[model samples]
Each structure stands twice: as C-alpha cells, then as structure tokens.
Target: METITNRTLNLHEAWFWHEEEDRLRCRLCAHNCLIAPDRSGICRVRKNIDGKLYSLNYGRLIAAHLDPIEKKPFNHFLPGTQSFSIATPGCNLACDWCQNWQISQADEVGSLTRIPEVDPKKVVQAALEFNAASIAYTYTEPVVFYEFARDTALLAREAGLKNIFVTNGLITPEANADLVTWLDAANVDIKAFDQDVYRKYMHGSLEPVLETCKALKAAGIWLEITTLLVPGVNDDPLQLQNLAQFIANDLGTDTPWHISRYYPQYKFDSPPTSLKGIEKAEHLARMAGLRYVYPGNTASSTQTVCPSCGKLLVDRDGYRTVLNELDDGRCPRCNTEIAGNWA
Candidate 1:
C-alpha cells in the first residue's frame, strides 16, 4: 500500500446528509452542522465541496493496531479475543480531555494531512491475518469515519468477523439506526452525566449520547458503558445515581458499567481520580441496581460474576483472561445467560 501524507480533494460522497438551499446539513452526529460551500462539518472530516458533502477521512488510516478486546475495555463483548482497531483523523465531538487528540482532533477541515488510504477490503484482510475476532472502529469517534467503517464492516462480517465501536456515543439516531446492523458490539464512553459538563467540556450534549446507548441496546447490539470518573467533576453521588439508574431502567441492569479512573491529561489539569473515589462510584452504581460494575485505569480485578448465583464467570489480569468459567455464554453455576457477544 502507498501512503499519501496530504490529500487536497475528496471524491467519496458522504451519506446521511441533505442539501439545503446553499449549505448541507450533516445528520451523522448530533451536531447537525450546516456546511457552506467548501466548508466542513464540526467533525472536520466531512467537507462540502462544490455542493456535495464528501467524507475527507474515509479509508485514511491515521492509526491501526492489533489490540486485545479488553483493551477496548469491552469486558463482556468478546473476552480473550483480539480486535483489529483502526481510526482516521477527526471527531464530531470536541472533547478537551481527549486522550487521542493528536489523531482525533484535526488541525484543518478542508485539507487532510492523513496517512495511507487503505481500502476497506485491506482492513478486513488485516484483521483476518491477525486472527482478530472483531474490527474495532476505535481510538476516536467512529461516527466521523462512518463511511470507512461501514464499508469495512460489511466486508469484515462477510469474512466471519465481528464489528464493534469504541465511541463517544454522540451519533445521531438516524446514523445509529443504520449502524446497529453493522456493529455487533460497542463500548461507549459516557464522558459525564451532567449536561452542563458536556457543553462546557466536551462541546456537545448529553441527551444524544444517552439516546445512542438505548438505541444500540434496543437493536440487539451488545452494549457496554464506560464513564471516566474525573474527581470533583462527574463524581457526585446524586449524578452517578441517576446515570446508573438510567442504565438499569433504560438500557438494563445487565449493561456492564466501567467506572474509569481519570488521570490528569491534555487540557484538563484536575487531580487524578482517587482509588477511594472510583470505589465509591462503583458502589453507587451497584446500589442503583446495576449488576455489573468495574473500576478502570487501576489495577483492579475486572471479573465477571453471575448476578444470580454469584459465580465467577471471567477472571482477568489487566487485558489478559486468566480463567473464563462460562459455558456457551451462560453461567455454569446458575445457568443464567449473559448479555454479550460470546460467540
């Protein structure tokens, strides 16, 4: 494959957008940015050039890696399996504290300073060569790279592989309605529960994120949630309770919740989430009737246990599984079915 460092023009016509009188409205994400002539959406990857919205980042792989599914932090999805993860530059949400800001946040919208434009088939072949069970559209918001992920996922599924997303969950309902078919599992990062925090920090809204989670669940795609617990930000008891309750009531109690410990990074200089703080957030989530909860970014045991019989199903040391005592996606002891893509 050949690598092109910079792309001046894009020909791939984008989906999920309609042309207005002069500008185009991109409905891929909740931003719904109206693009003028020669301008890009909020994502900075989809540009309106000469009256059509085109995906500037499609198949432009800024990063690709073979990673354990657990590293995606998808505890319940496909344990002990590896995923072929890929990402392009640009994300719809402008998260200030994004860990992968170098790739996720584009410097410009019109011109792309991207890597090799790998074909969708090439990504599938790479996944197969690596013996990956799934292709994870991760490390950045997959919504902005929808066309690439979608085409690649189709080929991946044909190759007997699964598709997943490690997303910010800012996808619009229309986009997710179509994505639910392509994706088999997803690990959504619910940045914070407070709407105010979302606007001020992430430059987005919270309700769409919640909606995307629900839509994914209702579509039978395996859903898991991660909340990066930043101390003194989204660590409040009441807020955590409501979020946990929403998961239990709307999504389900079986939805695995990962309360991640946040370290000071990027633009945010807040103190790291204390060990005690993550534990408390876990406590509140469990108290709200959520069956599976785990602490993240810490050396904690991310074990999966039977909510019915208390039998340990999966025992893990970091991303490696030491023991998985389940039988065909069900608890061996209680015979209760776990909600995940075990196959």
Candidate 2:
C-alpha cells in the first residue's frame, strides 16, 4: 500500500524516543507526550497519525500583522523597525493564565480550519511589502509549528529578512538546533523561577526552559527575556531575585529583560498585576546586575542611556524613534561603545 502524506502536514524533527513502551514518545518539550495512535500531542499541533507524527498547523497562519520589533519585547534588536509577526495554533504547556488561550488551547482541526492558508514564500514577501525589517513567530508557541517556522525562516533569510522567535523556550535540543540555524533573535519567556509554580500554574517544567535559554545564548542569538508578574503567584522577591541572577549569569547581563505587567486572562480571574510590582521586579533585575531592563504594556519611555556617564543616547516612544545622539552603537556623550548592532 502506498503511504499518503498531507500537503499541509509538516512532521517535526526533534520529538522521538525508543522507549520500552514501543511507542513514539514526543520529546519536543518537557511534556514528553506518550502519543497514542491517531492522537495529538499535548501541544495539539503535533499529532500521531497512522503511526507517524505530523504538525497539523504547518503553513496555516492564524494571525499576521506588521508590528514594531519592540513589541516583540525585544528592546536591543532593531529598536524601532517594523516586524512581520505570524503564528499558528497550539502550545506545549497549558498555562491557566494564558493570554492567547482562545487559540493556544483549541483543537488542532478547529484552528487549522479557521486560519488561512499561508505559504512560506508569501510570508517572506509580506515582510518586503510591509517594509518590515524582520519576521517574528509569535502570539503562540513557534516550536509547536516547527516545520512551518523553519521553512519560513529559510525563505525569510533568503529574502534578507531577520527571523525572530518569541517563545517559551521549552523545546528539545534537536528542535533548538534546527531553529538556531536560522533564528536571529529571540524573546524567551521565563514564566516563573519556582518549580512548584511551573507544575501548578503552567503544567510544565522549569529546567527545560532554563536549558533552552542557555542553548540560545550559546548559539549566539540576540537574546532577550521576559517575565510576566502575576499577583500572589511567582511574585515573591526571592523568586524574582533568583530569576534575575540566572539571567545575568547564564544569558548575560547585556540581554535585555522585559518585566511585563500581566492582566487577568484565560482561567485566572484575579486582578491584573500592579504597576508597583512591575517596578519592583525591574529594580530587582537591575540589582541583580542586569545592564538593560524595562517595563512593558505601560507608559515607559525608551531612552538609551550610557551606563558609564548616564547620558541619553536614543529616545523612543512607541515605535517613533529620535536618533538624538548615537554613532555606531556608542554613547555620544561619553563615547562608550554600546552592545548591539547599531549599523
């Protein structure tokens, strides 16, 4: 009998294990989903069909928009340029407070049916047409739709466009290797520092995420980290301090960390995170030796300051940027070289 392959199907590369169960265990993320025959993995995108696993949402883009690279929460990379952002449904971890739960938690067939058919080549073309300098795989976990994202990255690179991954960074080493080969920048969310919090709130492991961050750093990808401060959960000072210290030590002090204020969404019905808490997290991150840290989703100015002389370099509000005083990523006041691609 001839085997049938779906044109839209993109089988993943990293999820496999020859365990004693005689079943193909998905090693994509920390879940290690023991997929039964004709069943989908925890991510909902990767499925086991006819004894083979395939990503059902591949090349099916649910959302596409031209956004500011800064909106990807990446402050140090192409500061104010536009980025073509896209996402397919499904996520490895099921967070109760997921912001994009409508899509992330839905069935694969439902999401694929609703989202439009987006060709990989067209995604690259959209970037040029929209005058976007980069393309970001965001809104949902990019690792779940690994094949589409990887293929799109290749086309985007060929078109002289930078590829950014806005992810949870809870992927296997094999997937990371494939992605790092084409990924230019990343904004991985370090949800919480506590292992208990991971198990309870996100239903995930913290170690895999930490390992992924280390791998991204070692791959020399322009890395930034974000932490959503939820009230009465993962908001302890000790946890925040540990998270900041880990980022400073493992990811480097130069990596910009965005401490975002979280709004009550998905399953969580608590109040939104307070401005005070966001400010506090920022202070702790700076105290932990992070050179660049900022608060997001609020009224905060983006002024490039010289760490040495405290001189203002570049000023930004939203996406509008004023190149007031900077030459080759250096502070004009003190002539101190900054760490980023200014050219």
Candidate 3:
C-alpha cells in the first residue's frame, strides 16, 4: 500500500455548496447542514472557513484494506472479486449502533492528532497493485469524503477498475447524480423502514435513503440493499415486511436484500440479533417477491439460488465462491437470467 508521511493535506472545496447569510449550505447529503464561519457541520468533517465549504477529511484515510466484494454483502454484483476498501474519518449520520464508530466518529479538532493522508492517484494505484477488481469507498460514509472518493473513482475508472460505494443511502439527489457518473455498484444500508426509528436511533430520516436507492437504480448502478436486524429495535415483522415490499416493488424484485445480524456496539446495548430473527427477515423478503435474499453475520450459507429453477447457481462459504450452475449470468438449469455483473 502507498503511504504518505504528511499528516494533513490542503482542504478540498466541497461539492453542492451555496452561499447563505455569508455562510455555506452544504447540500452533500440529506442533512443539508448550514455552517457558519469556522464551524463544522453535523458530520464534523465539513467545515465553513471564511464563507467557503471545505471537506476536512478529504484524502485523509483512517482505514484501508482489501476485502472480498461479498463482505460488502453484494450477492449479484461481481460475486467473487476482491475490492480495495478505504474510508475517511467522519460520517454524516450519528447512528448509536455504528459498527465502525471508532473511526467513523473520530474527532480530530479537540486533539492534536492527525490521520494518514493519501492522494487520489495513489489510491487508484494501490487498487491496481493489489489486483483488486474494484475500489470500495466503505467502512464509513463515503458521502462525507465526496471529493476524495469522486477523484479516486474517476482515476480508477480510467485504470480499468470498477468503483463501489458501501454507503448509508442518505446522500442528496444532486450529489448522488454526480457520484453515479463513475460509480459502478453500491451496497446501500436502508437501516429501517420506519421514519421514527430512523430519527430516534440513526439521527436521520428514511425518505432520503429510499430516494437514494431509486436514484442509483435509475442511474444504472448495480445496487444491493442491506438492513441490520437489531434485536427489538428494527426487527419488528411489520417493519421488515414494509421494507421488503419497498425493495421488491420499487427497487425491483431482482435487487439483492441482505438481512445482516446486528451486534451490540457503541451506544446500542440491545442483545445481538437472533438467528431466528435473521431467518424470519429473510423469509419475509422472499415472500415480498424479492428474488435474492441472504442472511449475513450468521452461520447460514450465502448461496445464490435461481428463483425460477430452485437450483443453486453460486455457492458461497464466507467469501469463497464456487459457481456451480451459472452460465455466464444465467441459471444453467432453467436458463433464467440472474441480475448481476457476473462476467
């Protein structure tokens, strides 16, 4: 991996910005934070300095690794490829159960500490060197690091590598349209179906996320949805049914829905999601007419079976995939089309 000794880089001018009352209104995400002079947005990374919006976390990577695309929990898109995942140090939403809270919620303003900085070119080079098929802006919200992700994605595309975003699906329509220009695939966390649960636990709304999903689909980006089934939190049957129905009816039945088991983390003290709960959610998703549904963070096998033929197409054991009966992206048994970039 390429590393830089410089602890900080020059601030990047944020996108989707407009002047308001001598301040800057950051329209990058659903939050639409309005920042005054020398103040940061709710994300803690975007700051308004002298009436200009600047992305503080630009090119500052807190985590970088090569992970299986399946770890992104994408069943249909590039099933067995490795993706070079990277993340900056801040996020737009403050989820109490954030799994990567240590890095996502890291505050650098109070302390004199600094995160490692990298150039957008270097990031693309790293992905090429790692022999990764794609570069993933993941582990934290990529929307907060829009400039960095956008630049790297443009370069990566030129380098013949795909770009994916494992995001919260809360980005603004304008920003998402700009992002989809180079983005090839995404695993969007729907979080929950109820707006009240979103506001109470995730400190965000549900509509923007739903809109993002539709926008990505309309933009022709390969999309997958994930919902962390937190025990007694978002595991209600009615809510799960509604979420599944939306994904199937609106996002299309071919969209993959991953029901991930939520473990107690950060501020969330609830018990870990039960195996039975995961199964039930998966069942509901299938019942809602979703073609591909998988249970994550559990012992259940992550196999892709043909919804038409009832035959296994791709058998997966944690990231190790064995393509069994798939003929180029179709089911071998029934010659049914599977919705993914399998080639």
Cα RMSDs, all models: 2.8, 3.1, 3.4
Question: All candidates' TM-scores?
Answer: 0.95, 0.93, 0.96
Please identify model 3 stretches exceeding 4 Å from their true place.
Answer: 1-9, 110-113
RMSD of 2: 3.1
lDDT of 2 at 8: 44
* Model 1 stretches astray by more than 4 angstroms: 1-7, 109-111
lDDT of 3 by residue, 1-343 (tens): 2221123446678889899987889899999988888788998888887678878888888889999889987778777889999998888888999999998888846311366568999999989999999999999899999999999999999999999999999888989889899999999999989999999999999999999999999899999999999987788999999999899888999999989988889998888988988988988988899988988888767888888979988998877676656898888889999998997
Give the least accurate 10-residue stretch of model 1, judged by summed lDDT.
Answer: 1-10
Ranking by lDDT: 1, 3, 2
Comparing 1 and 2 on lDDT, the stronger one: 1
Query: What does candidate 2's lDDT look like per residue over 169-286, in tens digits?
Result: 9898877887789999999999999999999999898999999999999999888898888988988999999999999998888888888888889899899888899989989998
What TM-score does candidate 2 get on C-alpha atoms?
0.93
What's model 1's overall lDDT? Answer: 0.87
Worst 10 residues of 3 by lDDT: 1-10
